[model samples]
Target: MSARVPRVLAIAGTDPTGGAGQHADLKSIAAMGGYGMSAVTALVAQNTEGVRSVHVPPADFLTAQLDAVSDDVEIDAVKIGMLGSVPVIEAVAGWLGRHRPPVVVLDPVMVATSGGRLLEPDAEDALRAVLGLADLVTPNLQELAVLAGDALASSWEEALAQGHRVAREHGTLVLVKGGHLAGDRTPDALVGPESPEPLVAFDGARVPTDNSHGTGCSLSSALATLQVRHGDWARSLRIARGWLRGALERSAELEVGHGSGPVHHFHHVQEALETWGTVPERFSDELWEVSAPVRREIEELEFVRRLGDGGLEPERFLAYLDQDLQYLDGYSRALAALAARAPAEEARSFFAAGAVSCTETEAQLHRARLRHAGLEGAGAPAGEVTRRYTTFLLAATAAEPYPVGLAAVLPCYWVYADVGRHLQELARRSDAAAHPYADWLATYADEGFQEATRTARRLLDQAARDAGPAVRERMREVFLEACALERDFFAAPAAASRLPGVVAIEYS
Candidate 1:
């Protein structure tokens, strides 16, 4: 999972109704867990009913706003909407060419939802030129036709063709939306420059609502933010579409104006805060509850159950131990990196101690176990799962913020403690003295390790409290990702045991 909170800038017009343009862009950016900034190109006196008038700011002033943000902050992504005129469009294009933010999503806003023209007639060619600079272009059917220099598409196939043409001509991704078509299902396709056909398509049920006032602006901004967060176009599109769909489904709840109203931008966030409360005390509980399925899956693994019952083959057990030793080497380094970045002395001490424990204490235990099993000089290469998990940890610790690194490493301590306790109880219920993995279970389930887990949980909760909404969201995402990787680590040995001709594991 990507760790940092993306800083996204929206250069667009504004709606006093807060349903479209920069207002909607900022809302979508925040809803998608990004720090949002804005530079207004035009201020429109508009409502859900229609645009009364638009006041364009001078292009130089717009440039000033963009410069102010870029000079101070490192922009991770940019969302462009409603440029209004050729000069304003050129001003934005110039800034984009200069800064070249990592991701750029352009929403070609030609006409408003209430049938008001927002862009000047002579600016169509300029908007086309701007399309070449964007990473992704989100254009509704009407806007797509205008940019393609073709008639309005009456069918989905026609729309996709136009999308491909624009993508091919501009060398960028085009998001073609089907909301303007007459249908029960609303489909959206992502057309890329490399293919004549759409690279991906999402078919969703038409949401029954009249309050989808700024869906284009909202979705474009969401794409910009999510692209920065995930760094995969398909995954970003899927997440962005899911979020927009939810907002659209709940749009009528706002009831803001007489005509079409704004979608409820904070619907999911509101629900999450209500359930978890404003305090950080419930954060750990939330992580545990959300990861209950993974915990259950770990308990049900064939390797775990067999080990608890003294039925796992000796060769497989040794292989698992070898993988664990290899994993710990990388894990210890990640822990030391976290200690180096920790703000408080207590946290630094705790993580530093953990690194020492991983390298010295765990290493001794694994070596002693291997020597007892008559494999004193044997060690296996790290398997695919082990390599991937350790690489993720090292990358998170080295590249992400301190809080994000903390979240990434917390699952290793917490999940092991929980699973250890369960295994110890299972061994106790059924002949603990005969259980082959009794020593390993006791090591993880011991009171000292349990205390360490509690301490880590406490530190993470405090970190979440200190972080803003965007960073907190990022921490949660990283935690969940780490939990899934933990489950995969436990499952790998069992999966390997099922393969043919794999009776005796090889050691180097």
Candidate 2:
């Protein structure tokens, strides 16, 4: 028999707006790579702003929905959210006791993102009873305080303390989220009675966006899906947190509702058409889209402007070229390592060819420059910036996964291609006469190099699409770091002084 696709079930309320409740859960489950089924306990009259009212189904109907699904289809995981009344909570808890799923992720949806009450005060006791049935209980600081019957958690320390206390009381794992805490970082800790230390801690830089309406529901659903896939709670939380962050990063791009909008759960999908122009394909449109700030800095650099105008002194250009050549030496090896680990034959061949192309391209540029500078057999050592960048590349190749290594090496190809093409276009439009660096700029901006970049992006995208949340996030981190390094490498030559041996001579 064929292996079954993991079936993740969500028992929650419905939002007509499709931003929260069962709608958000289904979206998150599918995005995290799982088949989703839902049984509605309540129908919430809600939008992005707040919940107007909730209509709970009868207890027997809720039980019937659960039985209908569990009777035929095998459930791999279950995520419970927004039990509006005591009867619904008890009914669900009763179902849980009989047909226990392999994994149960409970999002204690006591409060909404818009500061509205989702669960009634009378339902709190029933919700508490339901907690012990869950594998993990995810609660924001406010929700944790309510569940633990304590004051609000004002700090991360207090949040952890509350989590530990609640976990001990219920004999379950409690995920205390610090997203509401005032800080630059958002920290979440999973604590239980069995261990003094936290089972896992997930920390992320706070994404500055208002489109976080369905965050709790999304996270809980993603956790259920990931738990089914990896079968390890800590690893599942790590990957789920990463995916949630990506969703938040791209949330602003989605236009869902008037108030705090919903996050873009499928933000990592490849674009229908390539919109990068001369810069090549991007692994995830979200990665490239979020790189605008760095790209702006590179565009405004003095070194880039000088190169475009052909006003850069030949000595400085040579020094930059020398550093670049040195950088390429290590870069080629990283490409070979990536090829060796690539999951597909097509990706393997692509990376292998990339290594060969790097060598040939670097050699040709160095040969031409050496002949022009009257140095036939001399080699230039790598500069500090070049050494650091190549070191990072080599390490990524050796240690990180294939997709991550590809991301680390991507900026070198993309940034250079973009800068080269921009400079070439500038040279074409500007009235600069007989530019010395014109041929060099033309070489890098050629169709050959552009095609190579396109190939690299396509391979990286294939890997990224197939990778899980944790690896995809790793790819993003590496891509940003590499892009930052690219900015430094471009700026290094302009910031540093002239070469020691060569005399300073500015061309008109």
Candidate 3:
């Protein structure tokens, strides 16, 4: 069955400018994969510059809007924002008490960026009552000070103290934002009633952008929506903060208002849409099909055909193993580079493990085989083709993005595994008791190597899916080049044997 989308309701004031209030909340909710709904408590006349005025709707009408939504749809989460008066706050608190949505994130929109008061002086106490009903409370330094009945916190330490006090008193989680603090770093913490210390603290370099309007509203709504999906407060906060940072970094791309403009809420969504429009559904299948000629050449090579029938000379086979040892050294380094540059944890771990396996397991296999052939001490230099292939792989991983690097190295895994399986099948059909090079053939055709190749394909396919048109084109170029290089690598041993002064080295 398909997963159900979270239905999140934003009960807040309206910003026709779409930078803050319910508009920002709705955008954030949708961006985090939730179905968004909003009920306006106030019609706010505001722009990036500042708020001109706020019109509070009648308490009964606000209640009616809230009831209309809860009566029909099941709300998974709610983000409460900008209640202009006591009656409005009480009305919201009343509805919340009755229905009690699974998750409630209250963004205490008390003070604006321009230092204007959004909540009435008399309504502070009422807003506190709503805090008890919320699962999480997001408050800036000014609102935090007001809730704790203390002076404005001049430092992060003072802010945490206020957050702890508020959380302890109300028995709710408080998200303390340090953007108002003076520093190169903007820190945030999730403080709960159970502990004096914050449950989790995130330290991030402040994004240098003037278009950070409605960050608090956006963050709170994102937290509410993400909570429904993850069901873990710390995980939700981590994802929400990362998304907000991306939005802040991309905010400059937008030209919403003259003053501090709204952040680019759909930055990731827009990129994903662009990728979906351009890239094919099965990108790896296309890569394989495009490189069919190269694979056919590899299968037709004299070395591969002779090796499959167990008639290839031992000196030539040892020469190939020697070249592969040199190639694996550089290949492992390239894998390490990919690991360091990977964006996701799973991809990073996969590439890191591949690097380790290449240097240890695969290298040991080559060393043992060469030792058994009585050429253990022979130190033959890499052939021209081997040097060229390794150099190309190293350059791609060092200089290009993750996608391009991934494409350049993929052929080594895919082509080797394909050739290994084909040769294994040929050996199986032969009348001989066993293929002389059965061990080597089985190494590449085994379940472990095949699974690893499949994983590499999956990673490249995902990278292609997320990449832009220009990046995908670069990926295709590198992939085809690497495939051609694989064919040359297979033919290198025979070519080297025929060259002048190429005497086979032997152990004493």
Clashes of 3: 0
Model 2 C-alpha lDDT per residue in residues 1-508, reported as the tens digit of each score: 1145669999998888887899999999998888999999898888998889878879899999999999998999999999988989989988999999999999999889987788989989889988999999999888899888999988888889889999999999998887889988999888997864798887888999988899999999998888888888788888888888989999888888899999888887634223233223445577888787998899889888888888877776776776677777888999888889888898889888888877887766775785678644225456677888989998998899888999998888888898888898878876778988888888877898898888888878877766666888889898999999999988887854444355552211
RMSD of 2: 14.8
How does residue 333 of candidate 1 score in lDDT? 95
Higher-scoring candidate on lDDT, 2 or 3: 3
TM-score of 1: 0.59
Candidate 1, 140-251: lDDT as tens digits: 9999999999999999999999999999999999999998988788999999988868899999899998887998999999999999989888899899888888898888
Worst 10 residues of 1 by lDDT: 498-507
Model 2 spans > 4 angstroms off? 1-4, 272-508
Off by over 4 Å in 1: 278-508
List per-prediction Cα lDDT, in the order shown. Answer: 0.88, 0.84, 0.88
- Write the candidate numbers in order of decreasing TM-score: 1, 3, 2
> Which wins on lDDT, candidate 1 or candidate 2?
1
Q: Which is the leading candidate under lDDT?
A: 3
TM-score of each: 0.59, 0.55, 0.58
Tens-digit lDDT track of model 3 for 1-508: 1157889999988878898889999999999999999999999888998889888989999999999999999999999999989999989988988999999999998977855678999999988877888889999998999999999999999999999999999999999999888988899999999887999999999999888789999999999999999889899999999999999999988889988899888999886687576777878898999999889999999989888888888778888887788889989999999999988998899999999999899988898988877656225766777788989998999899899999999999999999998898878877667678888888888898899999999999988887877888899999999999999988877653521223653311
